[model samples]
Target chain A: MRHLLTTQGLPRDEAIAILDVAEDMAAVGEREVKKLPTLRGKTVINLFFEDSTRTRISFEAAAKRLSADVINFAAKGSSVSKGENLKDTAQTLAAMGADAVVVRHWASGAPKTLADSGWIDAGIVNAGDGTHEHPTQALLDAFTIRRRLHGSASRGRDLDGVSVTIVGDIVHSRVARSNVWLLTTLGAKVTLVAPATLLPVNLSGWPVDVSFDLDHAIAQGPDVIMMLRVQGERMAAAFFPNAREYSKQWGLNDERMRALPASSMVMHPGPMNRGLEISAAAADSPQSTVLDQVRNGVSVRMSVLYHLLSGAVER
Target chain B: MSVRTVLQHADITRALTRISHEILESNRGSDDLVILGIPTRGVTLANRISAIIESVDSAVIPAGALDVTMYRDDLAQNPTRPTRPTDIPHGGIDGKTVVLVDDVLYSGRTIRAALDALGDLGRPRAVRLAVLVDRGHREFPIRADFVGKNLPSSMEERINVRLEEIDGVDEVTIG
Candidate 1:
């Protein structure tokens, strides 16, 4: 409960509890003055060893809405750029009395290391880490899904019978990994659809179905069709031959989008590769929960920070 | 050990009716009046009061829920539960008389938290407290404006208020 490093082994109750709390936080956002005095005297530091403006700003917004003082530490300009590692940076922040640290790093287990190393006393929240997990992203996705399915009466409910199909870039997507673990924990059936070259090598023991064909997976009538971003920057070598080929094979194209059930949802942890991974028609479709996911991210992050610093364990 | 019933179903109804009358009398006809219930049982009670007020005077009072989970002072000592939604009535609480209704008024800590929670959502004209049971071991200098019953109890004893809307039973029990 102190640090949300990953969603790999997060218990069902704890995961559901975070989602349920996020529902409350979302309700608060609906108010005229969207602000709370919960973390009044607390300080939350956004310690990013990687550049992620979206996540950094989302965490900053969450903290600010809760009335907590925020210090955004981007690695580029900070001591981290001067070769001062996480330990020195975290220790310095801790000394300044940061109540929580929302960290995004290129190293996979950077948040875990910061939490377990005892270099800092602040609660560690993983904004994201290299291909390992983006717990908040998964949590916000869950929140968005729950809200869509159950609406305002979503509290205390889990996605028991819901089927989710996550497509594209499974190899480098922390979002997909987090979703696979968290959604499975919350009782959703997950199916990972990717091109063969885009998938991970070892999928043994992971509680999900793997499919190379996106068309076949869509035919199964999943309740959610989550399309992950095809990280062009992360592609050192071509994971696929070309963008057009990749889009044709794996993307949620207009034809594939038309094939999806009306009840099913379209999702993306965005900065979406509109034409490449998901067609603009599909992304702009009413079935898309992409924007809802972004909006829910703030509330989900708020819930995480609340659980970590609000002086309560699980109920 | 078994529990004893302090107030039955009919008793709760009568108490609410009387409380509604008292509220109507005090507020002088529900103008810019908002009844905000602290979540769990309080929200149900608030809605009931709102319904009753509407029935009596034909005035549609805005009823909302105020969840004080994050504002709680004893959060460290209690187990963390998922927070309930805080739904403020449309048009906001600005310059409106807010009546915070709860199932029980024990240590007044919840009311204190509710007051703090209310502060963030625009300034109300006045905020008052209403409780089904006023168990007298208060740690804070807070009092209820409308009390269904002033059943004084020992610190060791617990007051359990079960409503039909929430628990499928309407009764107050002391254990």
Candidate 2:
């Protein structure tokens, strides 16, 4: 409850509790007022060291919906961009009385450092950090999955006996890393599908079934298929052969999309490369929960904030 | 699960009569009273409480059901059938003493969420919580102002209250 750095270390019951609470928070979003006075006088700060539209906005919205006063600090125009250290920024936010800080940083363990450094007393949440973890995003994805598969039945169930295939850009995707650990922890069998070069070295210790062939992984019939975005920015240094070739071999096109099981759900942590990692049709399909992931992000984040602030722990 | 019936139909009816008299005596009159149920079972409890008050006093107490499900903190953990419509009475909650009625009190989370939910309707002069069973395991620091029965039980044991309006039987059991 102190900090939500990663879903890797969380107990299954605790993680499910957060997801369950998010279901309630999602209800508040569908209301006429679209807000609650739970954190009436509390202050939440969105500290972004990296440029992000969805996560920053989602955290801001979640805080506002809970009636907490929000302050957005982006490194682009702020003092942090001008070479101010994280220590100074943490100290400053602390001085301003931030009850909770939702941080998205380029460095892998920035949130952990902030939470453990004692530079601030605020509850620190990792919005995202490098290729390390995006716990909240993974949580929302799991929330979406539990809703799609179980509905209210999520109370007693884990992702047990479910198979999840994560496709593309494993090397640079925090989503993939987060899901691999989280889904595995919840008892779902995870399979990684990507080109050998894009796959991380020494993933043998990670609890997942690895595959270099997308067709083979598809044939395995996973319960959920999470397609990761090919980071073109990271690929400018020739990480892959070419866009056309990558799309041909690893991309999710009509054939691969059609090959998926009827009950299987398709997911993507956006902003997507329309014709690169996944086609336009797959992104907009009925099986797609990309949009629902965005909507559920608010609720999932609200659940995180509520637990961190309200101190609601599952017994 | 072994369930022991704690309250019979007559016991419930007698408690309703006593609660109505107590509410009327404390508030001086039923003029500014508004009974609001906390959805599902609370609506029935609020109705019965309102009916009992009406019989004891000359004037009628306005009653309605408010759905606080949408304002809960954990909406996505379980599958929700989508948000249900709330039926608020004519004049709204402004300048009125809104008494929130519920069947059981566990962690006080429901009531805490209900307070936030009520603020959106309009500002109430005062808001009070009343529960049939105060089972005394509070995660949040919340308490019911009025109680029908204070049943002490472990967190593992649940108090199942079945009203005639919904369950076709009026009884309180511990399972």
Candidate 3:
């Protein structure tokens, strides 16, 4: 619970505890004054080595809502792009008296390296590190699903017997990897559907049922269908034949959206490529929790920051 | 080393009835009064008091929960406290006389947190405090306006208020 580097081995109890705390944060958001005095003298540093406007701003909003001072340090204009190592950059941030650091790097496992190096004596939160994991994204996804399913009675409840079908580029998605592990840990049955070329070869540790046909997964009436964004920039070679074929095969278009059950939820960890991964009809549908996921991301990150940096860190 | 029951079931019932009548008399018939309880056991007491007021004054008074976990001053030092439901009743607390209720009054810090929490929701016309047991040794300059019983005890001793809704008993105990 000290540093949320990965969701691969996160315990069910800790995950549920964070979700329950996120419920409190969501309530605080609805108040007349959307602020809390919880993390009052703490300083949070958003150290982004990668460019993620959505995630960096979400963490910043979460910290500011808790009355914490936030300092955003992007590597684009900083000394990090000038050949300085992570250890040196971390030491500089440590000297600035950062209580927590939300790190987003293009290299996989960079957040883990920052946490384990002891260069910065602060709680490390992995905003996103390549394709390794995005823990808070998964946590917010889980929070949104729990809210949709249980409404006001979501406290202390896990996703037992819930079926979550995640569809998209599994190989290049840290969001898919994080959600597969976390949703299953919360007692959900996860099924991953993607094109064979876009799916990862080494699925030894992923606890999910993989399928090449997206229609089969959608026809089964899952409780939740999450479409991950197809990272076109990550593909060096041609993974799929074409965008039209990919959308026709795996996209959550209007036809695929109609195949879902009435109570089913559609989700996307977005900056969505509409008409490519998910259609405009599906993304703007009433069942789509994409907007709610963005709204709940702040609450989930606030709960994560509160758990990691409230006082003495717990390893 | 031993436990003593200061207020039993009948004693609690009688005390809550008296507190209810006193609330009605002071608020002049519960017209613009909102009864909000600090969570856990105070919610039960607030509901009981609201019911009693309804029976006596024949007016429906809204009762809800006000959680002070976020407004706590000790959050940075202690472990994370799980928050309960902070359900503000339908008509809201703006310009209404809010009666804040709790099970015990000690250290005066929780009430302080509650006051800060109430400030964020909306400004009330007037705010009043009520508690079942007022154990002395307040840290802040806070005093409950209504008290069921004043049991001045030491720091080492614990004041346990068990309600039938949660603990299967209605009694105030000192150990």
Q: Which ten contiguous residues of candidate 3 chain A have the minimum total lDDT? A: A306-315
Estimate every model's Cα lDDT from 0 to 1: 0.91, 0.85, 0.92
TM-score of chain B of each: 0.98, 0.94, 0.98
Candidate 2 residues A1-315, lDDT tens each? 778999888899888878877876776676567887667778999999888999999999999998899999999989987899999999999999999999999899999999999999999999999889999989998888888899856654678888899999999888988888888888889999988889888886788888889988888888999999988766656777889999999988989989988788999989999999999998999999999999999999988887777734322
Tens digit per residue, CA lDDT, model 1, B54-167: 999999999999999888887677666568888888888999999999999998999999998888888999988888999898999999999999998888888899999878
DockQ of each: 0.63, 0.12, 0.66
Best model number under lDDT: 3
Ranked by TM-score, top first = 3, 1, 2
CA displacement after TM-score superposition, residue B60 of candidate 3 (Å):
0.8
Model 1 C-alpha lDDT per residue in residues A1-315, reported as the tens digit of each score: 788999999999898889888888887888777988878888999998888988989999999988899998889977888899788998999999988999999899999999988899888999889989999999999999999999978888999989999999999999999999999989999999998888999999789999888899999999999999999778899888999999999999999998999999999999898899999999999999988988999999999988898765442
TM-scores of the candidates in the order shown? 0.94, 0.76, 0.98
In model 1, what lDDT does residue A204 have?
Answer: 94
The parts of candidate 3 lying over 4 Å away from their true place are A311-315
Flag the better candidate by TM-score, 1 or 3: 3
Off by over 4 Å in 2: A312-315, B1-10, B13-99, B103-116, B121-175
- Residue pairs of candidate 3 with colliding backbone atoms: none
The CAPRI-style docking tier of model 1 reads medium
